[model samples]
Target chain A: EDQVTQSPEALRLQEGESSSLNCSYTVSGLRGLFWYRQDPGKGPEFLFTLYSAGEEKEKERLKATLTKKESFLHITAPKPEDSATYLCAVQAPKDSNYQLIWGAGTKLIIKP
Target chain B: SAVISQKPSRDICQRGTSLTIQCQVDSQVTMMFWYRQQPGQSLTLIATANQGSEATYESGFVIDKFPISRPNLTFSTLTVSNMSPEDSSIYLCSVKVQLSTDTQYFGPGTRLTVL
Candidate 1:
C-alpha cells in the first residue's frame, strides 16, 4: 500500500518564525509529490509539485523540496495569514492509472 | 490555473435527506475528481468523473450512495444520498490541468452539516 506520513502533527510559531514540515512516503513507484494549503472549513489550495529528487519549487515565502523518500515544505518568516494545514501527497504508479496517497497533514499556527 | 466553484458553500441538512453539490470549472478539463474530508482529517478521493463515461469510484465508495454525474467537461455534480450525521463533511471538487502530472486544483468546497 502507498502510505504518506507527515511529522509534527501540530506546530505553533510566532510571526516571522521559520519552520519546515516533513512528509515521508513509501510507494511502489513514485510519480510525483504535491503540496497544498488548506484553511479551516475550506478546500485545499495547490501550492507546488515536486517530481524528482533534488527538485525544489518556491512560492512567495513557501518553498518545497523533494528527496528520494521524503519531501519538505519550508516556510520562511511566516505570518498569521500563512497559518493553515499543509498537506503533502504522493502519486503512485499503477498499471495504467495513478492514485494519490495523502498524509494527515501538519497544522501550522502562526501567532502574530 | 483553473478556477473551480462549488455551490451551497455551507448547508445544514436533516438526517435521511440528500444533498447535491455542483462543481463548475472556468475552463474545460479532462479529468474531474470528487473528494470528501471529515473534520480535521485528510482529503479522501471519492471518484473520478468522466464526461462521456460513468464515474469511477474508489474503494469503500459506491455509486448508489454517492452518485455522480458529469454532463460535460466543465461541469459535474455529486449527490450524497441518505445522509447521516457521519456524512457531515466538506466535499471538494478537483481537476487536473495536465493529465500526465498529478497537479490538481480544488474548488472552494461545500461544507455539509447533518443534524
Candidate 2:
C-alpha cells in the first residue's frame, strides 16, 4: 500500500523563524512529489514538484527537496502571511492513474 | 498553471437535498478531478473526470452517490446526491495541466454544509 505521513501535525513560529516540515512515503514507485499551501477555507495552491532524489526547487521563501523515501518543505524567514497548512503528495508513474496519495498535512502558524 | 473556478463558494443546504458544483478551467486539461475535504482533514479524491469517457471513481466512492460529468476538456461538474450532515465538506475541483509534469491546479472550492 502507498501511504504518506507528515510529521509535526502543527507548529507555531515567530516571524522570521525557519523550520522544515517532513513528508515520508511508502510507495511502489515514486514519480513525483508535490508541495502545496492551503489557507483556511480555501483550496490548496501549488508550490513545488520534486521529480527525483536529491532534486530541489524553491519559490520565494519556500524550498522543497526530495529523496527516495521522503520529501521536506523548508520555510525560511516565514511571515504571518505564510501561515497555512502545507500538504505533500506523491504520484506513482506506473499506476497511470490520476489519483495522488496525500499526506495529512502540517499546519504552520507564523506569528508576527 | 491553469486557472480554475468553482461555483457557489459556500452553501448551507438541508439534508436530503442535492447540490451540483461546477468547475471550469481556463485552458484545456487532460484530466479534471473532484475531491472532498472534511473539516480539518486532508483531501480525498472522489473521481477523475475524463473528456469523452465516463468518470473514474476512486475506491470508497461511487458514481450513483456522486455523479460527475465532463462535457469537454475545460469543464466538469460534480453533483452530491442525497446529501447528509456527514456530507458537509469543502469540495474542490482540480485539473491536471499538460505541462509541468502533470501538476494539478485547484479551484477556490465549494464549501457545503448539510444540515
Candidate 3:
C-alpha cells in the first residue's frame, strides 16, 4: 500500500533556531507533494507543491525540497509565530479521484 | 487559492444525535472533499462530493454512516448519522479550485464534541 510518513513527531526550538522536518513517502507514479501549515483549531494553509526531484520552493523563512524517496521542509531562523504543525501530502496519478495520502504531521514549537 | 468556509465552527452534541456540516467556497471549484481529524491524529479523507452525483466514499467509510450532498459547484453538506462518542472529531472541507487544480484549500473546519 502507498503511505506517507513524517519524522520527529514533535520538536522544540528556541527562537532563531533552525530545523528540518522529514516526509518519506512510498508510492508509485508520484504526481505531486504538498506542504501545509496548520494552527490550532484552524484548517491547514497551503505552503508549497513539489512535483519532481531536486525541485525546491521557498516562502519567507521556510523552504521545501523534494527527492525520490522523501521531502524535507527546512526552517531557517524560525520565530515563535512560525510554530505550528507542518503537514505533508502526496498525490498519485493513478487515483482518478485525486486523493491525497497525508502524513501525521510534525508539531514544531519555536519559543522565544 | 480559494477561500472556503464551514458552518457551525464548533458544536457540542449528545451521543446518538446527528449533525450536518456545511461547506461553502468563494469560487466555483471543480472538486470538493470532506475529511476527519481525531484528536492528536492526522487527517483522513471521508469522501469526494461530486456535484449532482453521489459522493465517492473512501475505504472504511460508508455512505449511510456519513452521507454527503453536493447541490452545486460551490456548496456541499456532510451529515454524520447515528453519532457516537467515537464520532467526536474535527470535520473539515477542502476544495480544488479550477484555477489551481493541483492544490486544495481548506475551510476553518467544524469541531464536533460528542458526549
Every model's DockQ, to 2 decimals? Answer: 0.86, 0.83, 0.91
Best by DockQ: 3
The better candidate by lDDT, 1 or 2, is: 1
Q: What tens digits encode model 2's per-residue C-alpha lDDT throughout A1-112?
A: 8899998899999999999999999988887899999999899999998889999999999999988999999999999999999999998744455348899999999999
Candidate 2 Cα deviation (angstroms), residue A44: 0.6
Clash pairs, candidate 3, are none
lDDT of 1 at A39: 89
lDDT of candidate 1 over B1-115, digit per residue (tens): 8999999899999999999999999999989999999988999999999899999999999999999999998999999999999999999999987776679999999999999
Candidate with more favorable, higher TM-score: 1 or 2: 1
Q: List, in the given order, the native-contact fraction of each candidate.
A: 0.82, 0.67, 0.85
Chain A accuracy of model 3 expressed as TM-score: 0.96
Query: Clash totals for all models, in order?
Result: 0, 0, 0
* Candidate number achieving the greatest lDDT relative to the actual structure: 1
lDDT of 3 by residue, B16-112 (tens): 8889999999888768999999998899999988787889898999999999989899999999999999999999999988645589899999999
CA lDDT, candidate 2, residue A36:
94
**Candidate 1 stretches greater than 4 Å from native:** none
What would the per-residue lDDT of candidate 1 be over residues A45-74, giving only the tens digit for each residue? 999989899999999999999999999999
